[model samples]
Structures are given as structure tokens and as C-alpha cells.
Target chain A: MTQFIQQLINGLSIGSVYALIALGYTMVYGIIKLINFAHGDIFMFGAYVGMVAITTFKLNFFAALIVAMAVTALFGVIIERVAYKPLRKSSKTAALITAIGVSFLIQNGTQLIMGANIYAFPQIIANQYFDVYGVRINLLQLVIFFTSIILMFILQFIVKKTKLGRAMRSVAVDKDASVLMGVNVDNTITITFAIGSALAAAAGIMVGLYYIKIYPFMGFAPGLKAFVAAVFGGIGIIPGAMIGGFAIGLIETLVAGYGSTLYKDAVVYGILILILIVKPSGLLGKNVKEKV
Target chain B: MKNLLNKKNLVSLVLLVIIFFVFDYLIKARILTPYYRTVLYWMGIYIILSLGLNIIIGITGQLSLGHAGFMSIGAYSAAVVLASNPTITGLFIGMGVGIVLTMIVSFIVAMPTLRLKGDYLAIATLGVGEIIRIVILNMTITNGASGISNIKMLMSWPLLFGFVVLTIFLTNNFKQSAIGRACIAIKEDEIAAEAMGINTTKYKVMAFMFGAVLASVAGSLFATTYYVVKPETFGVNTSINILIIVVFGGMGSLSGSIISTIFIGFVNMALQPYAEMRLISYALVLIIVMIFRPQGLMGAKEVALNVLPDFKSFFRKKEKSS
Candidate 1:
């Protein structure tokens, strides 16, 4: 029972990060209908930025987190303006290909700058363990799990309450109608990228803190898994990402704990294929009838 | 008869034959070492793999990140057969079996996973590729992580060149067939093609099978060429490299795929001096080309046959045209 409880906490913590990354994937997909393949690299950038802040600025965890998010969000906006904006008027295929190109650019560029060695993150929040109901929990783990919940609620409030959020939502649903209603569609899209990138930065820091390792290629695996989670939860739905993240976390932990650790990736992917095949839109995704 | 005897295409064909002869003799004359010959062999293998992928990406309008999985199936199967049998004839039998088995596996795998679109297909295929990798990584007879080594070596310059010519011929013939037209139709618009009585699913499966089998065939050659087989060699990264070739060459263009394959193959081989930077450079090239030339070098255009010919023949053709 205690092992199960421990696994649950671990799952939730990692799942929170997946959820954060999934939000970035889902938001851009919802608005542009492009997968924005480079979004993972943005998450990677956030990790590097946070690592720099921690190493150079010698700041605490919270300060470094804020700085990383700001930098990533800024970079995301720049990417949107430079790479994506021009390709917007082109075919979706063009945009998709461009996104993949941007992803490769960032990943390869990072490899050039940082070299291939995995950088060790400074242990700002030390691995201090706490017991709950006879199950051990670490401080960083708790922080990840709770912070994500709080952030998710805050996001829900913003999307539901704020005017900018409503405008963004309107644009996602109907771009032409939103344009008619005086929403600066391009600006909204830029803001969406900024927000999503910021969220990804937060996830990046959490992962670095938990794992104590940061690499340029680290984003590929988690980002892919998060995308799967987004699809699993029902893409284009916010709550779905959160739910899917936690589900992925739990399943991953259980599989790794009970089964071979090497096969964990295979099992997770297998589950995703099963879910997609059986339930295409995901658990929360609505099936929008394609127009003939 | 005149259309069929177009002086331009005839000249192009002759030039190709001449180029092949030059290279063939160069290797045969010991001017090009066996190692360099091996590199050329990989170039041919990659061309086959990329062309097959192009049929799916450029023609059928599908994205797959798991092609390496099929290649692994071919490699392992061929390696096992060659190891157990130790006969040169077994190598050919192994390749045939590897290709057929890969086709069957891909067909089964595509049925369940084809529902996902866009990036989702990318993810699923990525997973499938990794799964195959891990499965191979854990298998006993495959030698797990150390990999299966000391397999029978059947690959040589002649065999490789023969296989390359055969693959190119088959792909070209298919490209000229009705099925190729159907694939193009599917790519242009799936729903519209379906409305026109084209079975999109069936065509997709057909195109995917063709690509997978070709990948497997390449895998067979790869196993024989390397004289060993390892799971790590054929993984997600290999799949990505193949994808980069097709995308860089211009999707749906056969000649483009061929040109890009050789270009990338030679560049990648030449860049071997800078081992770590090889992938990074390729990645940079992909980003730059995608932004500047999304349609790729030749776009969807084919190589113009008129560009090739002997000087006298060219003049004769021009005179004849006038």
C-alpha cells in the first residue's frame, strides 16, 4: 500500500509537468491547427535558460523559475513573429514543415552551443523526504504536484474570466468571426505562444529540479509523451491535458515499477496507440464533423 | 513512335549507363577502396529507403516516424537466417523472407495506428519504432544490447549496384502505373479522391507496404554489408534521417529523392571527420532548406531528359526538332 501511494505521488509530480507541456501543444494546435513541432525545443530552451540563471545569477529556485519563463516566453514570441507568421498565409503543410524545421534548428543549434554533454542542474531544493500515511514524499515532488494544481486553477480562472482569454478562445473557435469582433488575431496568436512557452518553462524547471539533470535532447522524450497525453486527454481541451498528464504519470510509474524499466516507453506508446485507435478524439475531445 | 524515340530521353539513359560504368570500373580497378565502395552501397540503400518513404509522404499524404522499425525487422530476420544457414543462397532467401515479413507486419501495424493524423502519426510511429528497438534490445538470439555480429556477408559492389538498379526500376515502373496516380490523388485531397471512387485506405496501405518492404530490402542489404546487425543502428534517429532525406529532396519527386539521397549521403560521409557535428549540420540544413525552399531543390519537377546527350547527338536533336 505504501509503495502504491509512493508511486501515485511520483506519477502526479511527473504528470503535472506533462500537463504543463501538453497545454503548450494543445493551445497552439487549437489556434493555428499546426502541431508546432518546435514547441518541444522551446521547453528545452527553458531548461537551458533556467540552468544559466541558476549558474550565472546564483538566484534561488523561484527567481530562476520566473527568469526562465520570461526568457522562454520572449523567445517563443520571437519564433512566432519570425518563423511562423510569414508561413501562416501558406498551406498548413508548409506551416507544419516549418515548425519541424524550427524544432531541428533549435535542437541542433543548442547542441552546437552547449555541446552534447548533459548539464547537471544545481540542487536548489534539496531532496528532503517527508512521510505521509507511511509513504515517503520528497519536497521537490510535492512542490511539482501542488504548484501544477495551483497553476492549472489560475489558468482556468484566466481563460474563463479575463477578456484576453475570451478573445483567444473566440479566435480558436472561429478565426474569421473573431477577426470581425475586433480581436487582433495575430496578436492573440502571439500572446498564446508566449503563454504556452511560459508554461513550458515552468515545466522545464520542475523537471530539472526533480531529475537534477538537463540536456538539450531531454525535451524530445517528455515533449513527445506530453503530446501523447494531450491526445490521450482529448486535444484542444485544457482540462483534458491535466487529466491525461496525471493518467500518463500513473501508468508510467506503475509500468516502470512492476515491469521492466526499459519497456516503459514502449508500454506508454502502446497505450497511446490503443487509446487513439479505440477513442480517436481522446477521453475529453469532441468529434468535430469534418465539412464535406 | 517518334514520341517514344525522343532523342532527349534516349541520350539521358545513355548518360546514366555511362556514369554507372565509370563508377563500376573505378571500384573494379581498385581506384576506389572497398570502404568507399561500402559508402556508395549505403547511398544506394538510403535512396531506396527515401524513395519508398516519399511514396507515403509525397504521394499518399501520410507521415511515418517508424520506418526504422520495419528495417530492423528485415535486418534481424535476415541476420538470423544467414547465421543459422551459413549458405550464400540463404542470404537471398533471407532477403525475400525479410521483405515479405516486413510487409505483413507493417500492414498489421498500420491498421491500428492510421487513425491518428498529423503529429499524432509522428508520435505513434515514433513509439512503434522505439518499441521495435526495445524489443530487439531485449531479445536473446538477437544478442540484446551487444547486437548480432558475424552474420554471413553477401553484399558486394556488384550485388549492391544490382539491387539499386532493380529498386530504382521497380519504383519508376510503379510511379508510371495507375496505383501511383491514385496515391497522388489521395495526397492532393483524400476526401475528394474518395468521392471519386478511390479507396483511400486501401491505397494508403498499399503505398505503406511498398515503402516498408523497400525499407526491409535495404535492411537486408545493410545487414549483409555491415556483416553484423545491431538494434541501435536502426532506431528513431535512423527513421528521422530517412525523413530528412525525403523532406529535403522534395516530397513526391523521385528524381529529387535520388539527388537528395546522394547529396546527403556524400555530405554525411564526407562530414565523418566531424562525427558529433554531423547530425547537427544535417539538422541545420533541414531548417534552412525548409524555410528557403519548402518545395525542395527540384520541387515536384522531374529531371529534364533534354539536358543530357553527347554533343553531336544534342546538335542532331536540335536540327531534327527544327
Candidate 2:
């Protein structure tokens, strides 16, 4: 049905955003083995920065996007250096708690500065739609889909072909071994954060453009859902994150479109529990037996 | 009886009685301001919650981020009881209901989660917690998000202070028990513990259930005393806030939890003027503590009176032959 196609479009648009965020989560988790809970906040930060770019400096939409991505990448590097780097040698609990702390700080700190009201994201790209055989599609949705796909391909290329990518992979496999091989584990981790954050920043800008709104608390739900996606596709796996992101997005969109909206969140969280229970290693993750 | 009548036990008991009366006098004589009483109330409540949480996180090394979900369940059930019968007897009934319900729900939750390790378990707990919150948000008894209100207050000073002592005693006793030691072994290494003939999952569930029991009692008190119960009261933010306190204080140290609670409670009270910064400050504290002192302020050291030098030892140092 046309209705199904229409819902699919909507789903892919949002799914692209989830995929972008999930990629970031997967990359950081792959490199550092930390969840990087603050990644969502970095996405939010990107949106805010983009807002400032347009409103204060009167930059064009593309320029603003670039600025957001660049600034957010730098921001991610800083967070890793300050909040997470010290605890790298410490317990996972400490790292996790610190990640949560950084998340809360960014959220509440933004609230204090921005106030609680929802702000309209700058609308530079005029909203337009096309109708074909009763299946109408928003131009922005297509834009989001293609742009994210291109970005994802670019990320894949970087990971597969670049020297830094090789270093990142080696570091992920064995930090001590990689260090002995002269990988510079710390810089590799920092670069991974930067790339992941930049991708999430792109997702942020697109989400704001798609929704036409941005709020300080907007990041939490998507952050969680993206985390689920990363886990679903098998965390620390790039391609898996992509597939998982689209699946969750489609599922969520379909649920909201057909079922009661209130249950949407419950359904998402339910999937999280189910996936974790069924496959703690995730869909694409290989089971590694624990050794004493 | 003989063990109960030991000198240390008697001294602690007498001290508790004396401290209770001192606070009782302050409340009865109206010497303590309402502001101070309110602060003490929250501090006591947080202490109770932290103690329960510590058993799972600190002592057992289980990461349970959904503790607030457990609190919400007990809180709402107890609130319903008090709404109908506003009496001391009702309070006990409410607490009993809370304990029973919390035990069942936590057991079911722990079944799947406890099998996993660290982050997976944390997310699963968070998922379950969020699911519980969302479920209550839609239920008829919960009255949705607006939640239940207009309950008669039953939180007397005696009951509040007594419950605090009871929770501490319970956690301390649990920590010293054989099962508690097994839980610790599991935390230290799950594989090794299982190899040592310990049923890892069973002991984990026991520790989790015991924690829920305490949280539920605290929740019952929260519903009765706070005179309100809403879904928002037990959200992820609230869980993180309580967790920050537990981690800030030493995880395995009861004295650290109590001391850290008092310290953070004072900091929050002082920040009443800047309400916006209050949450931000809590976030900063967690970050700072985790980064600078991941072992927590108290670590595993239980700072108690046993460490205190005797009065005679301070004055009679000359009796020692060199």
C-alpha cells in the first residue's frame, strides 16, 4: 500500500539518523570498550552549535553543518581527554559512571543556559514533497537518507583503507600489543572519538532539520534507542550498527504509525531486553568464551 | 543473648538510644527548625536507599541502575494502602506489601539480568526500569503521570530515625553473613566463584532481593512521609543522583555511605539558592569522584568506633616500656 511506502520513507529518514548515531556508538565502543554515554550529548551539542552558527553568524545551512561537525568533533576529543582519559586505566564502573556524569553535566548545563522552552531549528532547506502513484515523499527524507548513506560509505572507506583506521583496529584488538607495535593507542582513541562524534553531529543537524525543533532533553531518548541499535547489530561492529539502526527505526516508526503512541517507548525498551537476553553478544558479535 | 549483651553491642545500643532522644528533644522542644528536620529526613531516606544499592553495586559488584524503578513499585503500592487507612498499623501493612511486591518483581528482573556482565546488565536493568516506569505511567491505579496524591502524612521522627538504624543494621549484618561473603566472591570473579562451588546466580538473586527489601521499606516511608507519589519521583535522573551519592561515599563502606550522604546532602542544601546548578553539581561530583578516586571516598574501609583510640590510651601513653 501507498501508506506503507509513506511510512517506510519516514522510517528511513529517522533510521538514517539512528544509523549515524549508532555508528558513533559502535566505533567508540570498538576502540575504547566504553559505552561513551556522553556521545548523545555531543549530538545535542552539535545541534546547539549549528543553531548558534546560523543565528549569530548568519551562515548558510551547509556551512553551519560543517561548523557543527567540526566543532563537535573537537568537543568529543576534549571530553575524552578530560573526562575519560584519566579513568582509562581504572575500573569500567568508574568509566561508565563518569560517562553518565559527563552526560548529565552537558544536559543540565545546556538547560541552564538555553532555558526549558523548545527552540525552533533554523529552516534553511525549504520543505517540499513529491507524489508518485499515491506515495508521497518528503524531499528532506530523501536528503537525509542519501546524505547519511554517503557519510556511512565514507566512514567505511576510512576504516578499511586508511592508516589511522588500521591503527584503530589494532588498538581495539590489543592495546598493549598495539602499543608495542607503535600504534599510539591514546591518539587513535582520540581520533576515533572525533570521527564518531562528527558523524553523530551530522545526525543531529539532520534530526533538527527534519523535526524543525531542538530541545536540551531531546537527546536522551534517541541516545538510548541508538545504543539499543548498536547493541542489536552487535556493538563494536560498524556494518552491524548500520543494519540495526534501520531495523529499530522501521520498527519504531511502524509501531508509532499503527499502534498506540504511548507504548512506543515500552516496545523499544522491550526489544532491548529481548535482544540482550537472547544474544548478549549481539547479532553480529561473535561469542568469546570467558577464560579464568 | 550473651553475644547480644557484649560490651560493644551494649555501647552501640546505648549510644543509639541517647542519639535518638537527643534528636527527639530537638524535635519535641522545637529547637530544630523545619528546614533542618526536612534536611535530616531526606538524608535518612537517601542513606536507606544507598545502603540497599551498595549491597548490589559495592559489596556484590552488580551494576543495577534501575533501583529507582524498584523504589517506584514499593512506593506506589504502599501509597495505595495509606490512602485508604491512615494509621500506624497501615504504615506497617504498607511496608509489608512493599517488601513482598518488591521481592517478587526484583527476582523476576534479576533472573535475566544477573546472568550477564557489566554494561549489558546495566542496560538491561535500565530497560527494565524504564519499562516499569512506562507501565506505571499508563496504569489506572497509578493514575498515570499525575500520580496518586492527598495521602495523610504518617512519617513521625521516631519511625524515620528508627528505620534508618534498622537499614544500617540490616546491611551491616548482611555484609558479615556467609551469603554476603559469597556475593563478594562473585563480584571479585564470577568464574572463580562458580568454580569454588558457589551458586553464582542464586547468591546474586539473594543479594538483589535483600536490597529490594530495604528499598521497598524506604519507599513505603517515602510515600507516607512525602505525602505524594508520582512517576517523575523515581526516574533515571533520581537513580543517577542516588548512585552518585553511593559511589561518592565508599561503595563497600557503610560509614562511607552515611558520611558521604551527609556531605552531599549539605552541599545540595546549600545550593538551594541556585536550583538549576544543583543537578549540574551532582553530575560534577560523580565525574570528579570517579576520575580522581574511583575506589570512592571511603573505598572498602568501614570507619567505625573500633578504630577510635580509647580515652585512657590518649592519657596513659607513658605506661609503655621502651
In candidate 2 chain B, what residue range of length 10 has the lowest lDDT sum? B311-320
- Sequence-dependent TM-score of model 2: 0.95
Overall local distance difference test of candidate 2:
0.86
lDDT of 1 by residue, B126-230 (tens): 788888888899889788998889888787767776777667667765665789889889878888999999987888888888988999988988898888888
Each candidate's DockQ score against the native complex?
Answer: 0.48, 0.78
After superposing candidate 1, which stretches have Cα over 4 Å from the reference?
B1-17, B275-278, B304-322
Q: RMSD for all candidates, in order, please.
A: 3.9, 4.1
Model 1 root mean square deviation, Cα atoms: 3.9
**TM-score leader:** 2
User: RMSD of model 2, in Å?
Assistant: 4.1
TM-scores for the candidates? 0.92, 0.95
Output the number of the DockQ-best candidate: 2
Model 1's TM-score against the true structure: 0.92
| TM-score, first chain, each model | 0.97, 0.98
Interface RMSD list for the candidates: 2.4, 0.8
Top candidate, metric lDDT: 2
The residue-by-residue lDDT of candidate 2 on B88-124, one tens digit each, is 8887887888888889999998988888888778878
